[model samples]
Target: MKELDKIDFRILKILQQNARIPMTELAEKVGLSSTPVTERVCRLEREHYISGYHAHLNPHLLGKPPLVFVELKLQSKSGNISKISKRSAENSANYGVPSGVGRIRLPD
Candidate 1:
């Protein structure tokens, strides 16, 4: 494996903050030409230093409802799930049950 240098670390840091940043801009920020920056980015990817990129969006700003999701791996889907779901929707702020994982929309 190739050892990562200062330029490689800079590229990673910049990409982490804004993965959508243009190559030229990123290169300029790291004080390198675009060609070398591109090559470094590719090498970083090949080395598994960069796994993936994602957006951290603000749901409220985007006009999205405050919905919460819970993930679970259930051994079996049971009737208790229905009962809990109905009761939650009727009574608590929970608003749903866990059929593996529940979709609970928070109250406004």
Candidate 2:
């Protein structure tokens, strides 16, 4: 991969700020036409600069109001993070957690 130029940096910064920005709007912001912007974006994707996009949801609307941070501590036990994440994602709906927490917090 070649060294990224100013245009490349601008494209990355803009996309990082708003992944959902339209191609035309993004081009306008970056001072380029949609065609070249699209090309650069495609090149960036091919080079693995952008991995994936996600949505931020309001937990309250999903019947889960409380938000809490959790820390996982491990002691000499090695586990696959991908497997853990997959299992948690599969069982999230049952526990009423959208995607962040591993457990549900019921009202007192």
Candidate 3:
């Protein structure tokens, strides 16, 4: 990725706060023309700096009620743990669970 200048930082800051902000409004906020701002955004995405845009939704509103985190441990370490972890992640992704689960390594 190329080095980001002041304008690029400003654009990212604004977008992080509100990804849905229209390009015209973003350009005005960042003191750039809409066309340039749009191009910058596209470049950022192409560079993988911007993975994707999404809407933040309330889980309760979706009838899931409150959510909780559960730490999992496996007995085996010879790839069994990795296999189980992959399966869990796949299930969560498939079900579209908000704040979907992930694996975290614990320090010994």
Taking all chains together, each candidate's TM-score versus the true structure is 0.56, 0.59, 0.62
lDDT of 3 by residue, 1-108 (tens): 788889988988899999999999999998889999999999889988888889888765665544444445445545666666566766543332223344432222
**Which candidate, 1 or 3, would have the higher lDDT against the true structure?**
1
> Candidate 3: which pairs clash?
none
lDDT of 1 by residue, 4-62 (tens): 88888888998988999999999999998999899898888888999877778877787
TM-score-better candidate, 1 vs 2: 2
| Most lDDT-accurate candidate | 1
lDDT (Cα, tens digit) per residue for candidate 2, span 1-108: 867899999999999999999999999998999999999999998888988888989777887777544444433344665565566567544342233434535453
CA lDDT of 25 in candidate 1?
A: 100
List per-prediction Cα lDDT, in the order shown: 0.76, 0.76, 0.74
By TM-score, the candidates rank as 3, 2, 1
Query: Cα miss at 89, model 2 (Å)?
Result: 21
How far out, in Å, is residue 48 in model 1? 1.0
Let me know the TM-score candidate 2 reaches against the reference structure: 0.59
Clashes of 3: 0
